[model samples]
Target: MLTQDIRQSAPVTPTQAGTVATLMIEEETTISDAPLFVPEDIGAGLLLLGLLLSPKPPKER
Candidate 1:
């Protein structure tokens, strides 16, 4: 419901705690304070998460 409203809103803003995240994807988005996480950055972050979650070798006691 909220997402739908945001999607339909003329201007959208994403806030966390009290600060807004800046959006860099578009000038028309109007989410200037919204943090912009680029596709490449998100991909890299997901890759790092996968690596961290993968099985690890046994450590010596």
Candidate 2:
């Protein structure tokens, strides 16, 4: 989400007072699958995780 501040120069009606307004802007979106973490990526991540979690041999004194 994004936002922008907008100030009115003058009020439309004599009885109304000028006011500041906030204009909400939509966040940019990309079509890339990296952020989505697709199935294939999840699989690869799990494989890497398994390798990291594997037990190592005891170190000799």
Global CA lDDT computed for model 1: 0.64
lDDT of 1 by residue, 1-61 (tens): 3554334535544454224433433346454686777789689889999999999989999
Off by over 4 Å in 1: 1-38, 57-61
- Give lDDT per model, in order: 0.64, 0.67
- Model 1 steric clash total: 7
Using all chains and alpha carbons, the TM-scores for the candidates as numbered come to: 0.27, 0.27
User: How far does residue 17 in candidate 2 sit from its true spot (Å)?
Assistant: 39
Candidate 2 TM-score, true structure as reference: 0.27
Model 2 spans > 4 angstroms off = 1-38, 57-61
Which pairs of residues clash in candidate 1, taking residues 3 or more apart in a chain or in different chains? 21-33, 21-34, 21-35, 22-33, 22-34, 22-35, 23-34
- Residues 1-61 of candidate 2: C-alpha lDDT, one tens digit per residue: 6797888785466333223222244457766765564688589889999999999979999
